[model samples]
Structure formats: C-alpha cells, structure tokens
Target: MSSSAEDPNKQPTLYDSSSSTSQPLLSKLNTEEPTIRPDPPDPDPEPTQFLQISYNHGPRPFKDLPFLILFALFVLSTFAFGIFLIFNRNPNHGNVSSYTYDTNSSSCVDDSLNLSLLLSSNNWVLFNNELSSSDFLEYLIWTLVVTLILSVPFCFLVLLLLKHYTKQIVYVSLPFFVLFPIFFDVYWFVACTVSSSCGDSFPLLYRILVLVFVFLIIGVVVWIFVANWHRIELTVNIIGVASYALSRNLGLFVVLPLLALGLVFYYAPIVVFLVFARLNGKIVPKESDGEYSCVWRQDSWVPFYYALGILTMLWSYTAMVEAQAYVISGTIAQWYFSKEDSRPRLSIRSTLRNAFGPSAGTICFSGLLVCAVRLVRAAVDSAAEEVPGFVNFALRCCVNALLASVDFLNKFTINFAAITGEAYCSSARMTYELLKRNLLSAVFVETVSTRLLAGIIFVLSTIYAIAVFAILKGVAKLGVDSYFVAALAWVLLILVLGFFVNVLDNVIDTVYVCYAIDRDRGEVCKAEVHEVYVHLPISRSHRSSIVPRPLGV
Candidate 1:
C-alpha cells in the first residue's frame, strides 16, 4: 500500500508482475512501468479476523508446561486404569501371574499361549465361552475381502469427485465426519434397547459393534492406502533414477523395510485386537472366587509410566512419519529445482537426526494430540456404558465428532510446528489462519493423499505378506497358525507402506501448508502442478493459490 498521493483515475489493481523471477530486485526493473507488483494483496480480512485468537506475539498470560505435563499424566492414568480393569475382570485370572508384572516390566499380563492350539485346534475357549478363536480370524478375513471389494472404486471415485467438486466434497466430508459418531451412538443405543434380556441383548450388541468396527477400520484403511498411491508409484517409476542418483543414501531402502517390520511387530494383531476389544464393547468379566476385587499388590505408578512410555514410543513413530515425510519432500524439492547440482551433498544420518532429534518434542506433541483425543473419548465411552441411555450416548458421539474435527485441524498446526519450530497453541493460531485461507487445498491434499497412499500400501503389503508367508512356511517350517501369516503380512505391509507412504503424505501436507502460508504470493515455481494431477484426488485445486504448471514443464 503506497502512501504517495495517487491519481484519482488509477484503480487499485491487484498487481502481479509478468516477471517470472521469484527474488525481485528493484535494480532489475527493465522499464519504468512496473506493470504490476505481483505482491499478493493482503489476505481477506474476514478469514484473518475470523481465525484471530488470543495467541500472538505479545502474549503474557500463563505457561502451558505444567498443564501439558499434567495432561500427559492424566492420559496415562486412563490407560493404566483400563489395563487394571481388564486384568481384574479377566476370567483367566488364576492362569495369569497377576503378581508377576509387579516385578516384570515387559510382561504385564501372562501371554502363555499355544499358537497351535489357539489357531489350528478346533477345541478352544474364548472368554470362558465355547466360541472358537477361529471366528475372529474368519471375521478379519471377511472384513479384508469386503474392504478390497469396495476399495478400488471407492478410491478412484474420490479422485473424480474431488476433481469436479473438491470444495463441496471437502465441506461435506468434514461435517459428515462429525455426524458419523453421533449416528454410530444413536444406532448402537437403538440396537441395545431392542433387546431386553442379557442373552439376546449382549450378542446383538456385540455383532453390531463388530460390524461397525469393521466398517470404520476398513474405510479408514482403504482411504489411507489409495490416497498415497503416488508414493509407491513414484518409487517404482523412479527406482533406477533415484537409486542411481542417491546411491549413498541407498541404505534408506534397506532400513525402510526393517523399520517397517519393527513397527509392524509393535503395531499389528495385538494392539489392534486389544483396541478393538476395548472400544467395540465391554468384555464379560469372569467371576472372582471370594471377593470381587483385586488389591494393588504393587505400586501402581510403575505400570502407568510404562504405559505412558509405550504410548510415547507408538506416537513417536507416527510423529516421525510426518517428519520423515518432510525430509523426503525437501530432498525431492532440492533435487527437482537444482539447476546445476553436480551432486547435492546430503548426509542421510545428519538429516535423520535433525528430523527426529530437535523436532522430537513436536513429534511427541502430535502423538499427545492423539492420546488426548483418545482419553476424552474413553471418558465419554465409560459414561455412555455406565448410563444406558440414547441421550448420554448421543452426547458422547457429539463430543467424539468434535474431537475428530479437532484432530483434522491439528494436522496443520502440527505441520506449522514441525517446520517453523513453534509451540502447539502458537502453531494453532497460524493453522487457523492457514485453514481459513486455503481450506480447500488443505482438505483435498491431506484427505486424498493419505487415503491414496494407504490404499497403495495395502496392496503392496498384501503382496509382501504373501511372499514373506511363503518363505516362512517353506523355509522356516513355521506353519504356525491360521491367518497368522496373512494377518502378520497385512500389519507388516501397513507399517512399511505406511511409513514410506506417509512420507508422501507429509510432503503433500507440507507443500499445501507452504502454499497456504504463502497466501497466493511469491513465485511458487517449484510447485508446478500438472493439469493431470490438478484433477487427481490429492492435487486437485480450488482455483485459489495452487497454480498448475503446464505438464512436462
């Protein structure tokens, strides 16, 4: 905004210089006529004002350190309580060395199991009932089959729909995501109320739960895989080129699969199963011999912290998923834009350290965000269970829906923190403005890329699982159970594919974040989006800041 006296006839035009140079210098002005400044006019006042919070430069209210610490402990306490409740309610209490965990940090609960008897044998007891464990595997298998059936079209349809109606879809999906939880509870309450007796009521409830769980898990999984399809596609297409160019960093190829395996070992079957049991419905606790209580034989502090550590480790993995994605994006961007790069020096070790080390807290914060949401959901779920009414359950669902919205919004804040090295609330204020500015692109890229990559990962994982299973069965001679190999395979694929694909996930995320922050200003020459990609799910544009370069640029 020039303060010089302006001609009354000169209309305040939104100037954009035809000059392509990003770093503009007045000395390089060829002619007197500065056709247009190209500087983006100030952002729309509505969005900035709409997103204004108290968090800003001159803040002097209170410290969040103590609050964060207490919040972390509160989350850990919930998990610890749940674990204690699980153990106390178990029918196989005598079988479990409940006192042993007091001494042993590793084995909190007895995992003594015959994989053979559990997986292959027909005679098996589940939860003190005659139901065979095979049922679970079958259910999982069926769910996978159905997911596969729906995934192909579901993924591609999103691509097309986003192309034509990106804004509408984004707006619709967000609100719909919030409403889904409410619908889930309303239907759940209805189902439970339909049955009066314990025998009929519980089974129906369980069935409905399992089905709903399957729907959600499958939908979520499929969406993620397909959204990130580009990463795998990129890797396959450029395998020779990238491998040759960055041969020194070739270890990433080997390290990725191994890391995937480690992540899989931690992520799959057990964690997923336990989460399902906890969230799906309440497990029937077995009868205690004398008293209906198990005294805390040891300090409860130990187990709770242990659970916290576990949560930290798990969420840290997720956090790195975002960070490493940033790393890859920066690397590729450098590679692509460098005009005279004989060989751009990159110490992979140093890069990894920087990504994970200094940004460790940011990563943890991302995880904490998840844990916080889960803790809130747990509290709501507990209340819903204790007070059997549609009203309570509906409220729970509404809260959950809002939390889901929060989680979506938090990604931008997390990205801002990751790049700019800001605190949570600080990043949040920035995220609010960013979203208001580039809401459509943010929604499209995050939603589409995540799902695309996840879908691709699923397919790749299935193939990898098959290969691994065959090798294990034939060579190792460890034919150790039904769907164990398959399930393990799925988990491994998820981890490996998820980790790498999420790299693309965060890349797309970061690029859009940058776009949002840049706010229709600057030479976004590096982000020369292709017309074809402009229609693709993840890269779809909203006629805003995202300017697509002609293909083959």
Candidate 2:
C-alpha cells in the first residue's frame, strides 16, 4: 500500500527500506520455542518401502520370447523333415508301400549319353533314382555328414560374397515386370493341342530332346565344375546370399499365402463334389480297385464343368506362382546391393500391401488361362468320351502335359517381369532372350531343381501324411475316422511340402534370371554379380558363363 501510494510506475525494490521491508525470511520464520515441522522425505528411499508382489503375468502374444522360440522350433523341424525326406525311402503308410525305390532298373542306363540313345534305351526313367540310394538310410547318413562337413566353408564363402553383393546389384529393366503371356501361353497351348487333335500324341523326339537337354545341361555343369570349380562356388555363393534374404522375408512372401491357398484348394474339391452331388445326386462314390473312387454320372456338366473347374484351378495356381515370383525376385533384387547385416526388413503388412495389389494382374492372367483351357478341354473331353481308347487317353495325357509345360514357362515370364518390372509381353520377350542366352544353366536349374524337389517334396509329404495316419490310427487311436485323419494329413502335407519346395523353386529361378540378364554389363563393369566374383573365386567373364572355377583358389 505504501509503495503504491508513493509511485505507481516505480518498481518496488526487494531490499529497499523505504519501499519494502528487508525480509530476512530465515530469521523471520524461526519460531521462538523450536516448533516441530514434518520431516522432508529422504532423496534416497529405503528399499523395503514399497510392496513387491509376484503377480501372474498372462501368456504373451506375438512378442520376442514367443517368436524366438517358435522360430527356433520351426527351423529345427523343417531341417529334420527335409533331411528325412532327402535320405529315407519316403515310406508309404498309405499304400503299406512307398517309393518305388528301384535302382536296378534306371541304374543300367547312363544319364551322360545323348538324348536319342538314352531314349532308345528306355530313357523314360533316365531322371529316376537321382540321389544315391543303394540303402536309403546309408544314403541319408552320408548326405547329412557331407552337408555338415561342407557347411562351415560354404558359409564362410557365402559371407564373403554377400558382403560384396550388398553394394553391387542393380536393376536392368523397367518397373512394370509382369503378365500378358501368363495366360497367353495357356491359350497357345490349348490351340496347339486342339489343332493337332485326335489320337496322335507328341513325337518321342520331343520327349527325347527334352531329356537330352536336361542331361547335357547337368553334364556340362559337372564338366564346368571339374574344369572351373570357382563358377560353382560363385553360383553357390549367389544362391546362398539370395536364399538368406529370402528366408528373412519368407513369412509374407511364401509361407502365409501358401498355407492359406492349400487350405482353400484342399477343401474346394470336396465342396465341388458335394455341390454336384446335392444338385444332381449323380456324383456317386463307387469303390473300385483298392480305394474309394467317386465318379460324376455322365451328363453335360460332369466332365465339362468338372474339367473347367479343374483347369480354372490350375490357372489360379499359376497366377499365384507368378505372384510369388514377383515378391521373391523383388526382395532378392532390392537387397542385392544392401549390406547383409542391414538389408531392408520386410514388414509383413507392408509387403502384403505391395504384393496384393499387383497380384490381381496375375489372377487375371490365370482366369484367362482357365477360360481358354476350359474351351479346349471341353472339346477334348467330349471327343475322348465319344472315342474311348488309348489314343484318346494318350492325346489327353500328351495335351495336358504340354499344357502343364507351357504353364510352367510362365516362370520365365515371371522372372523377367520381376527383374525389369516391365509389362507382360515385354517381360516374356526379354525372358525368352535371357533364357536363350543362358539356355543350358537356366533350363537345367529351372527344370531339374524343381522336378527333383517336387518329387522329393511329394514323397516327403506323402510319407508325412502316412506317418500321421499311423500315429492317429495305430498309436493314438483317436475317435476321428481314418478318412478324416487321412484328409487332414494329406492337406497339411500339401501345405508344408508346397511351402518348402516352392521357396527353393522361386529362388533358383530368380537368381538365374538375374544372373543371365546382367550378362552384358561388360569387361570392366556393371555386372552386379561381378562384385561377388571380385571377392574370392573371381572369374574374368562378365556373364555367369557356366564355366566352373578351380576347386580352391
């Protein structure tokens, strides 16, 4: 009040005697009789001050511990199953008989011989007994031992190459790589099959040439290995590096979709049968020979619609395969020049987002293939039913086989599209050119690896199904019906087998395509793969020229 009265504008001074009291707060606030005050809390509290209870922490969701454990278990299981499949005589509980593991038949004919001679000598079984199996268990043991022994050096070599590849790979084609030929080839195959119509099957020369191509490619590879072991090492290193990247992102790329599709495919056949049965009661189950065989009572719809549905399914499968190629090739290519340790992490949600949209093109491709084949197959079926004989059967088999081969050629288109991100026709053209350039290696790897793997995986999966049957029927004695158990095992086996082999297939194809297209990078040059060659086991050639490098240096 006094200060305000003196001067409104003047600031009140804290220690000015005239304007304000010089308050010595410590002395002013002191009590005369030592008044007691509540003690301030200690800065360092006592350890026992708080109550600590061990409450139940509920089971965790997809977190670190669970994921780690699950991943570990999955890897171990996959490895164990893979080893057994590779080595054992994939026992067949389904037939109380398994693999026709007969070495005596195919052993006499050498795979090294020319295609014509090989075919003349019953080359039908030329590719049979691929792995050594005088005694299945013995072969398995040796493979396992050899695998383990080579693992260390193999890993070291891969690590070195990966270090280089992390900063070397580049894109050659535009960013639209995918589809017109996917379904296009299906149409082409159908047209060809029908044009050549009736009872005349494909020439044995076609088969012979195919077999020769496979044999020559593999033989050349072996020769190159002996001559130039380094090429093999480089090739392996590339595969290893690509495989590692693939495995890291495989959840979104391969496994999830495969299982989902497997479930759909497995159930679709049953649903179709039920629908056909309910509508017409014509689809009847008759036990013929050793097992229950269901036949759709002949009318217009039985074979026509049935075959249509089947063909449509095959096309859908092809599309999915193409889609898989898109994701896999991109992932491998994108990470090709990245540091191995810090390669791009594939987020499942985001990868799905990216792949799902583009996948529609492939789906459309499949639908087209299905439609074309549907028309052609209808004719084929009508003719076959009218004229029942081996000729018709042979025609059906040969045409269908051709269809299958043509369908598989989509892989080439897929590889091109994946790398260049180009449109379908362009990709196919380029893919053709690239494969033409790297013909031997590309064909050999694509066909042989996939075929070998398919057989192994099929055998393995069948064995798995039978094993499950044994467990459920013989040991567990579950109340579930044998057929139900069989169905469950069969479906699960399909999914698992499909997942494992399909991954390898895509990987091999992508790597080969990438290597082939980059062939022109030049003498000093842009061949991203050359960086890998620069590591150890260097090659002078720019192309992955099927030449093997020396074994060691």
Candidate 3:
C-alpha cells in the first residue's frame, strides 16, 4: 500500500498535519501560549538619565585662613595701640581740673579746713569708698567665673537634651549650636573693643582662652558646613526660586497686590486718624506715632525714603526669583529633551504646562481680585467723612478681621498644599480643610490658631487701649503738666503687658503644634525623609585590601 492511501489511520489529524508541515505551524501557535516562549528579550531597558545639579559646597578649605591670620594681627595691633594710648595719655585728663568761683558770691573767704580734721572726720567714709572700688572689681571677676561655670553645665545639659531628641532638635537647635561660635565671636569682639577703649588691659590668660575658642569655633564651623552641605544647597535653590519669581512677576503679582492691600488696611487707617484729628482741631501725630505723612513733606520724607528702600529690596528679591525660575526651567527642559524614552519628554511638557501655563493665569487673576477688593475698600473709606464712630469702628474691625482671616488662609493653603503635594484651586476649600484638620486635634486648635487667636488679641488690644486712654485722661485731670509722663506710663504699661501676653501665646501655640503634628498624627507632614549619602566608616585594613586595578591595556 502507498503511504498516503493505504490506511484510514495514516490520514493525519488537522493539528498533526499542521505540525508536520515544513513551516512548523504548531511552534508558531505555541509561541502565543502563556507557559511557552520567553518574554521577547525585554528590549534592553532605556538607561536612566541622571540630573546634574551644581552648587557651592562650602567655603574653600583655606579661603578664611587669610582672614583668620589678618584678624589675629589686627587684634594684636589693636591691643598694642590701646596700651600705648592708655600709657601715653595724661591721667589728669579724667580728674577734676579746678573749681569755678561764682562772681556773685557775697564774700570770698579762706575756708580751707585743716588737713588733719578733713582726714579724721570723713576718714571712715573715704576708706569705705576706696574699698568699694576693689570690692566691685572682685565681685565682677567672681560673677564672670560663676557665669562661665554655670554655662558649662547648661551647655552639657543642652547637648544631652539634643541627643535625646535629636530628630526634633536637629532642625531648630542644631543650627543655633553650630552658629553659637559666630555669636560668641561677635560678643567677644564687642567686649574687647569696649574694654580696650576704657583702658582695661587684655590679660594673657584671656588671650589664650580666645585663641582656643577660635580654634574650636573653626572646627565646629567646618563640621557644620560638612554636615549640612545638601541643606545649604537646597536653601540656596529655594532662595533662587523666590528671587526669580519676584523679578519676573513683580508688579503683576507681588508689589501691586501688597501695596494695594497695605494702602487699604494700613495706610487708610492712618489717613482716617489724621482726618479725624484735623476735623477735631487736634494736632496730628508724627510718623513715630503711626500717622501717615505725605511724601512731599520734609518731615515725612525720611519715612518715605525708608519705604522706598524696602520697595527696592522687594523688587530685587523678585528679580532673584525670576532668575532661579529660569535656571530651574532650563535644567528641567534639558533633562527632558535628553531622555532616551519619549515618556519623560511627555511628562516634562505636562509638568511645564501645569506649572507655568494656566495655573499662573489663575494665580494672577486671584491677586487682581484681591487688589480690586482692597481698592474698593480704600475708595469707600476715603469718600466717607460723616460716618458714625460705631460704624467706622465696625468697619475697621471687619477689615482687620478680614485681613487676619486672609493671612491665616494663605498660610494654611501653603502648608496643606506642601504637605499633600496636591494643588488646591479653591482658597475657601483649602481654608475649610485647614480649619477642619486643626479643630480635629485639640492641641492643634490650642496652639497655632492664628486667625481666631489674632482676632481675640485685637479685641483685647482695643480694650487695653481704651483703658489706657481713660487712665491717662484721669491723670491729666489731676493737674499734671507733663504729657511725657502720661505717654511714658501708657507705653510702659502696653510694653510690659504685651510682651508677657505675646510670650505666653507663642509658647502655648508652639508646644501644642509640636505635640499635634508629631505625637498625635504620627506623620510628620512638615518634614520629609531625605536620603543622604555619607561615607561609611571603613577600617584601614579593608581600605588597604582594596587593591588598584590596571588599565585594560
């Protein structure tokens, strides 16, 4: 029988026939099977592009060495100069030269007491006075020693506290500790200068102590610089960003809005006060008393100049922000364009579009809206003259309340957006969330409730001012001729009361906020986990064992 026609069993099934074919169809079909062929070689993954960011690491190793040497020479030169100045000068320069005689005296008599009588009668008083100088010097020296001794234990205690709460302490306290030397140097220089000017000698022991302090300060500075290199860079970057923003969008977003707001909330009130004074035939207060003076007036020009300088600084800061923005944008653009995959290119465009496109317009629009509101309020206040005191007071209160609310809202929105990395378009919504989140935690509400607390503070301040006015008016009715006395009393009372109140509020707020965020939530939204690359401490043996390899030649 022929192979193809002999038996029915010899006729292949469809699958078998296809498998036996020269094309090997079954293998092709199996390629699609889940269990079968290898994953198409994974197409060599695109290389991950790295970002190159350059920054000033720290002062050059020996940049300050020359300064240090110069400073040392200056100190020595000053010390020598001071000694020469002291020794060469006449001691009698400070002494009473002569007693002046009045021509109108009825008689001139030889009234000189006997030397022995003068010595004996006031001898104890003279001796006590002489010893008082020595006693003061001894006391001063003892006090200094005691202060230094106390500081040592205090410093040690602070160090222990820092170590115990390193995570919390590092952000705020460590910087202060690192910068303490700089502060100490300033204090020392001032002290030395004052002493040298007053004919006090710089002791050898003090000089040695200062030299040791200098070296220790240098070491501490170096350690801090090394430890916070990345942080320093980040701070620079942030400053740059702010500067760039300020420069590019100055009048449109920052200056105009701020000026407009100030005109409405701050200057307008001063103007109202001035108008009230003029109408009531009272003398308008000076700039020092918070009255607005026109720029053209000579007396007011100094304050105007000061304001101009501040405005100039703001402009300069804006320019810096613009520069930083440009730099960052250029860097991001370059990075995106240089990527191997198209995905990153798309992402970069999207990011830019989101950051600098429609969102910017929205921000500007919001600023304009705020400016318009401020302008309207100013216009209304300016136009009104016969407004009732209660109405005016209510209006002022409303304005202040609004400003406080807005400021709080601004802060809350910024913090919330930063924490979430999510842009919230609605300010009202953001404010609500902020209020809700804070209220949820009793501690948070107690501490950091700026808007509510500020409102309360304003009310209390108004009440205090009224009380002060009443007291001063009552005192004036008591036949006092001096306005200075009344003013002094008023100022002293406010200062003493305000300082304590502010301190108490700040302490409570700070403690509560810290507890709320750190202890209550267990999520530190304000702080981010930063990955730092530090050189692992390697033993000399391990380092030595790492042999150098030859070139591929």
What is the C-alpha local distance difference test score of each model? 0.48, 0.46, 0.36
TM-score of each: 0.45, 0.40, 0.22
Best-performing candidate as measured by lDDT: 1
Task: Supply the TM-score for candidate 3.
Answer: 0.22
Question: How would you encode candidate 1's per-residue C-alpha lDDT over 230-264 as one tens digit per residue?
Answer: 54343222222222223323345444445556666
Kindly report which residue stretches of model 1 are placed more than 4 angstroms away from their true locations once superposed. Answer: 1-296, 299-364, 463-483, 517-519, 530-553
Q: Candidate 2: deviation at residue 440, Å?
A: 4.7
Rate residue 36 of model 3 by lDDT: 57
Q: Among these predicted structures, which one has the highest TM-score?
A: 1
Task: Residues 289-353, candidate 2: write the lDDT tens digits.
Answer: 75444343444433444444454454555445555666666565555534445746553333344
**TM-score of model 1 vs. true structure:** 0.45
Number of the candidate with higher lDDT, 1 or 3: 1
Candidate 2 lDDT at 345 equals 58
